[model samples]
Target: MDADRVNTHTDARSETIRSATLELAQELGFAKLSIEAVAARAGVGKHTIYRRWPSKGALFLDAVLSSHETILEYPDTGDIVADLREQILAAVELLARPPLDGLFRSLLGEAQQDAAISAALNERFIAPQTQRTIDRLEKARDAGQLSPDLDLELAMSILSGPIYFQFLITAQPLTHDYIDRLLAALFAGLGPRP
Candidate 1:
């Protein structure tokens, strides 16, 4: 094969592995996924898997990035509270699913152990999506809705933390009501405490 063909083939093969990783994660989950299973599912050799990703964790992260579930489409409706409420409600709905919630929890644990994986999640997954929400907050501040002194990062953590806490603590049936309750309480104390 020519050099271009070789590179193309490699890229195609890598995508196949990532696709298999997604299916396997849905069925077997991230913690239970294996290179052997991925290779078998992808109809590729173990060497291909080894060449593409250094570990199952890396492969799983790529699969997650490639998966539809990981893609968050947060909207900007000009009304920050309405926008935030919708975004949080969507997140709650997505995460309430069984394998997805389990997969994210597993990913969080794996992220703690793997520096590269954590960096990947933070950069590719979390950072960009987070910037969208933060941008909305910045817009809100600019529009004089949020207090100018509000810390964007801290505001995000406070907003998401309680919902995630509910997911972690009891895996409760999260609803729009819960999202509302969370936003109500957090936003109450976030700004100048009026």
Candidate 2:
């Protein structure tokens, strides 16, 4: 096969595998999801999956993250607040829905016990998303929408921390109102000056 044909074939197989993984994960939940099942569903051999991913966790990570790749991206609409709100709302909506919510929770649980999974999750998903948010914040700061001295990393954390806390720790509903309140507080600051 020519290089182009080979690349196309490879991409098709990868997409098939990722789709099967997601379907199986949604049906069986991540705890019961296995590479064997995914291979069978994808009509590919177990070796095919193993060749691409070292472990089930790695494959699961890729499948889940890839499924929501576009939603995870930050928008640049000039109005940083509106752009951030749109992106955050999309993220929260994903987390609030079926399959992704359960899948993400399972991934987080697995990451806590597996160092490889933890590192991969941070490196592949968390770090990149965090950097994207920081890059947007930097633009806002440069444009004078955000305070020039504001630590972008901290700002990113500040924006995400409450959402994660509600999602993972408190199990509260991640409503649009909740996000509005969070953003309001973030931009408004707290208390009277001393």
**Structure candidate 2, residue pairs in collision:** none
How well does each candidate superpose onto the true structure, as a TM-score? 0.81, 0.90
- In candidate 2, residue 3 scores what lDDT? 22
Which tens-of-lDDT digit does each residue in 1-194 have in candidate 1? Answer: 12221121236777788878888889887768899999999999998777656778767766765655443666777888888888777665555566677887788778788877677667666666678778889989999888789899876677777876787767676876777877777767755744
Best by TM-score: 2
Model 2 misplaced stretches (Cα beyond 4 Å): 1-10
lDDT of each: 0.73, 0.83
Clashing pairs in 1: none
